[model samples]
Target: MVDGISFAIGRGEFCGILGPNGAGKTTTLKMLVGNAPPSAGKLWVMGFSIPAQARAMRRKIGIVPQSDNLDPDFSVVENLAVYGRYFGLSGREVRARIPELLKLAALEDKADARISQLSGGMKRRLSIVRALINRPELLILDEPTTGLDPQIRQNLWKLLRHLQKEGLTIILTTHYMDEAERLCQRIILMDHGRVLADQSPQALIRDSIESHVLEVHGSDLDHWVGEAPVPERIRCERIGESLFFYGERLDCLVASLDEWNGLNYAYRPANLEDVFLKLTGRELRDG
Candidate 1:
């Protein structure tokens, strides 16, 4: 259901697409790989037109799907060999790339293990490496770290950054605001099948939200708006039990915390999540 969304990515860039459920993130990824052809519009990848030169375009890019579809029957190394052949590599050529990919994924010892025996993080790491079997210039990841634990997610984040340093253009879709903010040099925010904002995280935070956020918890916090200091720049919004005050100057706001001594409050810089919630909303989204 995506409508008229367009943007171009340069080589060696790390970009992220952020959105709520049913925002056409997956559909857009599918079209890039030519799995779902665009009904109307020109689609190009690596200097080749999609669906017309899909075969050629695919050769220049790799995809890491949300799910780890590794065959439980195959050993980790065997998986790479099999996928390499899909790119028309000779058996010898595939074998030569195994050591390099395994080293990149830090799976040298686990190479002989059965896919079923690998941990969630290991499996995810393997999926990323499998996508690299073809040595693609561009790597597309769809919610790659959705269910991983924090530690594993951090590891994967480091891995992705390392890959980016190696000069690969990486495009990822993520629901984790911190992930997008930390990993992507640029972010494309989408909702309701359209692009809402496309810019760097810093830029988005600066433009879409105030510089700081003061969060307080209480049952009836809306009545406390007049109690905030320097109320001119502050914009207040209540979500559930917490009331957030956004503004450019927070010194006065921070001092106001003493007035409500018993109630709990925290103040920090505004982030991408704040901007996203401000732009889209704090409501639930059902597909």
Candidate 2:
């Protein structure tokens, strides 16, 4: 269902695709992997057109989907062994690589354990290793850390960084702004199947909106908005009982709002989440 969305990932670059729910993040990933065909426009991965060169592309890419699709009937090691076989690796080669991959995923101790016996985090780490069995030049992950604990999430981040350092181009889709900020050098923000903005996290935050945001809470947001004098450098929005004012001229905005005694305020530097909410709007996108 993705439409009119376009972006490129450079060699060895970690590019993050970010958007809220139903923002076409998953659809974009599908199109890139040739699982879904684009109704319009072109998709080129590693300079090869998608769906047309899908077989060739698959050999160059490794995908770790959002869900754990590991075979529940097999042991952790068996799963990796089977995946390696699909990539045409010999049994001896697969055996030699199994222990190393397990160790890399921190699952060497659980190699013989059935997947059903392992925890969610273990399964996630195993899935990542399985995708890498064929030594892909490009790695694609769709919301790779969803449903994992914070510690496990951090572990996955470390592993991803290690892979990126080894010259792998990584493309990931996520709703976690912090993940995008921490891992990606370049990011694409999408909403309602359209590309909203694309740039590095720091550049997007700096250029799309203000550096700092003043969050104001009060009983009557409209009353405050009506009374507050409009400043040329700032943009304000009312979300429920709060007001978000974005601008570089924070001191002036604070001075102008000093007369409003009922509103409690806090000033903080803006991040990717702020840019997302502003570009996509505050309305609840239930879809």
Candidate 3:
């Protein structure tokens, strides 16, 4: 259901498509991989037209879907063994790569364990490694670290960075602003099947939002708003009981609010979440 959604991913580039729930990120991904045909406009990947040359195009691509589609009947090693065979790999080749993939996913110890017995994080890691059995030139990951713990997520991040260094192009979708900032060189902000904005993470933060943000906490937000001196470049908003002041010069605003009690404050550089909320609005996207 996307319209005029066009963007390019360069070789060895790690691009993140970010949005709230039901923002068409998943739809866009399916169309790109030829799992769902676009209603209009041509979609291409690595110079090959999608949904038409899908069979040929699939050979050059690897996909890690949002859900873990592991076979419950099979063991961890069996899962990779069978998937590698689908790529036309020989028995010896599949065997040789299993250990490496298991090691990379940190599932070496669970090689003989059945899918039904593994933890959520272990299953997720195995799914990612399964997608790489063919050594695809372009990798597509849909919410790759959705249910992972911080330690496991960090491990995957390091592994992804290593793969990117090997000249593998990657495209992923995520809701985490910090993940997008840490992993993506360029990003597209999407909402309701449309692109809100697209730029490098740093550029998006600098250009879309103020350079500095001042956070204030108190019981009377409206009273504070009435007494607060407004600067030309500053924009203020309330989230719960806290007030956020967005402006280029946060220090000046901090000095102006010295007389306000219970207003503990701190200034921080702009982040992707600030730009995301500014462009897409602060409404809950439940779908």
Candidate 4:
């Protein structure tokens, strides 16, 4: 259902596609990998027309889907060996590359470990290296760190950064704003089957939203706002129990918080999440 979506990722670029649930992010990815053909419009990857040259195109690309589908019956080494054969690799070739791939994933010690013995993070890393069995020029990751803990996610980020530095073109789709901001050189923001914005996280924050944000939440927030109204220059929105204030400066707003007892507040620079909410709205979106 993606409509009017047009963009190109250059060689060795680390780009992120971000959106809420059911925002056509999955649909766009399906078309990119040739799993679902686009009904209209020209599509090409590395000079190969999509769906028409999909087979050849696929040979040059590696994909790490959102969910881990690693075979539980096989050990880490066995799993890699089996997947390598899918790319027409011989046993000897697969065996030769296993050490390097295992090293790349930081799982050299777990080479013979069963899939059931691995942690969620270990499985995710294995999934990544599994896709790299062919040493693809382009890597596509769909929500790579969705369920991992913060430390594990950071480790995955380090691996992805290393891959990019090694000259691999990577396309990552994620819902975590901070992940996209930190890892992606450029970000494509999509919603409701269409593209809303495309820019670097810094550019999106600087150009599309206020410079600063003040988040105030606590009891009797209404009474405080009634007693001392937000300055006209500052934009304000009340969502549930919190009041969000956006503007170039929130010094006055922060100072005002002291007068209200039991009110908690935080003042900080605007970020990718702010831009996303401002564009997509603050309301909850259900899948």
Candidate with top TM-score is: 4
TM-score of each: 0.96, 0.90, 0.94, 0.98
- Residue 169 of model 2, lDDT score: 94
* Candidate 2: tens digits of C-alpha lDDT, residues 1-287: 67787677789999999998999999999999999988888889987899899878888789998898999999998999999998888999899989889988988789899998988888888999899888899999999998888999999999999999999999999988899999999989988899988899999999888898999897655677776665885777778878888887677667766777777888889998898888888888788
lDDT of 1 by residue, 1-287 (tens): 78988989889999999999988899989999999989989988889998899998898899999999998889999999999999999999999999999998889999899998899999999999999988899999999899999999999999999999999999999999999999999999998879999999999998888898988886435555555555664688878888788888777767766776456888999999999899888789988
Better of 3 and 4 by TM-score: 4
Record all residue pairs in model 3 with backbone atoms less than 3 Å apart, i.e. clashing: none
lDDT of 3: 0.87
Q: Which ten residues in a row have the lowest lDDT in candidate 4?
A: 225-234
User: Between 1 and 2, whose TM-score is larger?
Assistant: 1
Which residue ranges in model 4 land beyond 4 Å of their true spot?
none
Residue 236 local lDDT, model 3: 85
> The CA-based lDDT of model 2 is what?
0.88
What lDDT does candidate 2 reach at residue 39?
87
Between prediction 1 and prediction 4, the one with superior TM-score is 4
Model 2 Cα displacement at 258 (Å)?
9.3
Clashes of 2: 0
Q: Where does candidate 4 clash, by residue pair?
A: none
- Top-scoring candidate (lDDT): 4
In order, candidate lDDTs are 0.90, 0.88, 0.87, 0.92
- Ordered from best to worst lDDT, the candidate numbers read 4, 1, 2, 3
Q: Please give the distance, in angstroms, between residue 109's alpha carbon in candidate 1 and its true position after superposition.
A: 1.0
